[model samples]
Target chain A: MMTLIVLGTLLYSQYRKTTSDKLKGSGNVPYYLIALLAIGMAVGDDSGMTMILPSRGLLIWFDPILEKLIE
Target chain B: MQTLRISSNQIAMLTGCFLSAGMIVSTSKEMVYQAGQDAWTGYFFPMVYGALIIVISIWLYKGREGITLFELNKKLLGGIGGSLLNLVLFWYLLSMLITDLRKLAEFVKTTLLLNTPVSVTMFMILLLTVYLTRGGIEVIARVGHLYFFLLAATIVSLPILLINEFSLANVRPVMANGLEALAKSSFMAVGSYGEVIAMISVMFAFSYQKNPKGLHPMLRGVVFGTFLLTVLSVTLIGTVGTSISARAMYPNLMLVQSIHITDFLDRLDIILVSFWVPSYIIKICLNYYVLTECISSIPSEKQNPKAYTIVLVPLVFMMGHLSFESVVELVHFETHVWSFVTVFLQVVLFSVLIVARLMRDRQRKKEVELT
Candidate 1:
């Protein structure tokens, strides 16, 4: 439901020509692409697909190494 | 960026509110755990570190009165280098936003909305943050100015309200943990205080306001924020003792829960939470605003701020959801990893900018001599 609302808003804003010059010249491609990717990941996670990589795992891979250094 | 202007006072208020909100609830427990009874004293080193950050930021701002750190990077480092540095900043700001949203969601889930999912809480907060960000910095600062007083009053009243529970004995034997313990605790505390660097991103917004003193308002705000956090640190350890506070998830919340003025006036945590929620939201909004600003400033082409806000909402929501497995992990990452990252990035950024500025000055001087 929330995803639909965000998608609807993005679509409606683009349809209304409210996007700025940069977005319009790019045909709102990047915005839609990001929206799709984010929505897909969110939906995949909701379905117990284990597709959404946890941000900590992605960002803090060096934590164990850094922890040892700090210790 | 929009040409709207806000006073230095508003900036100070926003900074103070942001710093205090970020530090008060989240860090007290860890400070206690690391510094033992002397946790309140640990802020001394952070105080010095925060002052250096502010002074360097002010010096940087003085060199380029109306330009943002993003634009400064572009001017000093050139195209590719500037974009690379901006990318690092974007990552840092986004990570901070994700962590804050997760922390707030965790707090709401554990304290207020026991049945609500963390995603719902994060989504709701992001919705409000998006709304505020779209309104731009003026609206955010106005809201900050209004709420600053209320936050100040609530924080000030904590010690008085909890006087009965406060045991000076808990904070006694000052510095008994030795300078080593205090130094280690101060290192932990520095991460939160180091957030004073966030002011640099928006210093450009202050260009329209004429202040002869120049950035003193920001320094004042940092001092005010540090003062409030110091009071909170002392109050928490005094009220609950080091053992109980270190064990509790939210030590400040625990302190508030102990407030018992009278039977009718008891259970003030709900009221206190209501006041605190807005301050925390202000912090989130400021961070979100800065992140969007960094992005908008990156592309040579002008970008729509509203579009970025809307597009990033789902991404932020997902990241917030996936950031930490539990509060313990979140706290561990922040204290151990995030601190080093912020301090290192800030130091490198400032040093490079200052060095570049000096070299530019020297080159210009040599050109003048040739002429």
Candidate 2:
């Protein structure tokens, strides 16, 4: 609803600014809806998951090779 | 749309910005890595082939001085003839834009919004691209033009993050892979430059007439863009070794993350994220604007580009969403299918257009001489 309201306001304002190209509710519907859906889906998905931290031994092994290399 | 028509220097900036497309830099890294310390050689050999690809594409562009492949098709083939060909180009570009969006989403998820939902991050980027696309091409280029400082800052700070990790020895045994490896790596670089063919459409939106000087700046921008990609490839291979760098995902970012950077800035990669997000903005908007211009060439949409953009915004969002199911699928398509399309469509189509234009030019010249 808030998204819709915001869209309405923006459309109304755009219509006012251009005057000739008046606010067609249809103007930004697809754009805004796509945005809203992407947000809903992305935010709603797993937020707590984390990539597994590499093993200590792996990091240690990497450290020596990388130490000489990165240093 | 109007913004797409930019000064040559502006196009130069875009030349650099568009390199953010994962196909060129990221895929090459993987191909090089997959192919090992031997990767660069594989890449280099291909450049000879890739240069053929670039030459074919650039020659096509050169065939016509100002017009691009899109318009050339219409002129040469007439209605259905040209539209059918360009539809392929559109699909090719749209596919790239979708995957590129995924890259942006993944980058945000891994770096800044680790805790944020992937969809939301994707949404944020879509919102920006749509808004900018609707804002017009000139605005997109202007924003791209304005972003150089941030882009440069990120590139410049890279050495600081990986300073500890780089080794001259890591890059030793340069020709260890023989000619084959070097050749392959260079072809991959050709794909990288090939992606810039989208710029021609952007050129049509902006006025290049009074200022033919635009070519010099545009070429310079491309040189700079190419230099940036080369430095990144060489640096990543040197620091991580072709072996590890090839295997690692986002080797560029990992090059940053792996560093402690004196502990306080334990993760400076986040700072660079600011630049990364916006770089995609420049790219996606440019893509959206080009798509819009292409669609508008249809008689109706020419009258009101707004309707097309409104319709295009979600279509693009959905296209981006639908193109990749998982990272594996996303990256896979990007590396193989996407690379070929990026190369062939831009290169081949333009080659056709260029030949057509040159023939036309000669006819005009001969007619003048005869008269």
Candidate 3:
């Protein structure tokens, strides 16, 4: 996808531009976190993403239970 | 570093407009639906609640001039702790941005640009937001000030324009379902109206004209927003009656549709749609700036703030597209999921920050005296 390519380039550029300490210290975790989140959202149901966080299999079981509670 | 400064009035307009703009179309309908005829009460609850949030947030930053909540997070929580919190804040703001874009896209698709794809509409708005934000917050604040009157006039004049249709009987049995229903609706209102918490990002961006009276122009601006929202709710319920307004997706848009104006001016919903554009853009830009600022807190990111917007555009587009099954799902998410999380962040997280700041200050004072 265009987004993946763009993001890959940005990440590579960012990775090359800054040191590991700066990246870690500057709070670059969100870049990876958000990249994964976008992929999960785009893949839809199969991504098994929960509404709350970006973990792959973490809350997949919980969402259905929450839905049942709403019902 | 060259710091940008906007007046307190600009801050007030920017924050006030950001908070109130989309309520008429998106959130107020749910409140009316939940509380029946008494939904006007929902407006008052969040007004008081939001004002308190502003007070506490401002007080927390009172002596700590030039510091943002993001910096406070770094100081109190340390690098890793703060980065993790920043991730949480990113999720919060990003989720909001996606939702707002979806709502705006929905409005555009339904009312104005019927043939346009929702993704296209959303992309268009985000494109504008990126442009606004690249100018930095000052430009956005100035734009909010410039168009504040146009936005306010369009919103306030709607109820007045449709005064002929209101029925006093509509809101008659005000607390018919009693306090419990009202309380439920108020809780939901926190998600929609109490988003003033987002303004804390821009709090330090404001340069006060005078040496600070307690929350002066900012509080007034917030009160004005609340007043507009309350009036909007009252007008919708009074005119369309509670049951009809409750069921309507956009009660205010419906109100605009009801106006004949003249034979020539009948399709005034188009013009009303124009009002939402600036206000919604202001809101989106504010949130986007906050998210970007949080992201930029990473040392590598400090070099390129606007670069992230390029990456965010497709992510936002996809999230807005894929997040909900329908408008029903969107409303359900807003009431059930988003409301509680937002309140928790505003109240509980803010309290933690205040306590942490106090302890930090005490330790600093002790060291000063020791020296």
TM-score for each of the candidates = 0.91, 0.75, 0.87
TM-score of 2: 0.75
Which predicted model would earn the best TM-score?
1
Tell me the tens digit of each residue's lDDT in model 1 across A8-32. 6556555544535445454354466
- lDDT per residue for candidate 3 within B1-371, as digits (tens), equals 56778887887787678767857666777777778888888767777787887777667776666756676677776766666676577778877887787888888888888999887787789889988987987888888887777878876897777877878899888789788768767766777665776677656645655345666666777788877777777878888888878788878888778777678988887787787778888888888887777676654334345546555665666677667657776666666567766787677677777787788889999999999
Stretches of candidate 3 off by over 4 Å are A1-46, A49-71, B208-211, B298-304
Write one digit per residue (lDDT tens) for candidate 2, span B1-371.
Answer: 22334676776687667764333325645556544555534433333443354345444445355555566567666666676666666666666566677777876777677898765677678777878887776788788887765776666566566778778777676667665545444444454556666775546435454345434454555556555555666666667776667766667776656667676888676776676667767887887777655654433112344555554444455445544556655554555444444655566665666676677778889999999
Worst 10 residues of 3 chain B by lDDT: B298-307
**Alpha-carbon lDDT, every model:** 0.77, 0.57, 0.71
| CA shift of B173, model 2, Å | 1.0
Order by TM-score, highest first: 1, 3, 2
Model 2 CA deviation exceeding 4 Å by range: A1-71, B1-5, B20-25, B38-69, B204-215, B298-303, B362-371
DockQ: which is higher, 1 or 2?
A: 1
Candidate 1 residue pairs in clash (backbone atoms < 3 Å): none
TM-score of 1: 0.91
Q: How many residue-pair clashes does candidate 1 contain?
A: 0
Off by over 4 Å in 1: A1-40, A43-59, A66-71, B207-211, B302-304
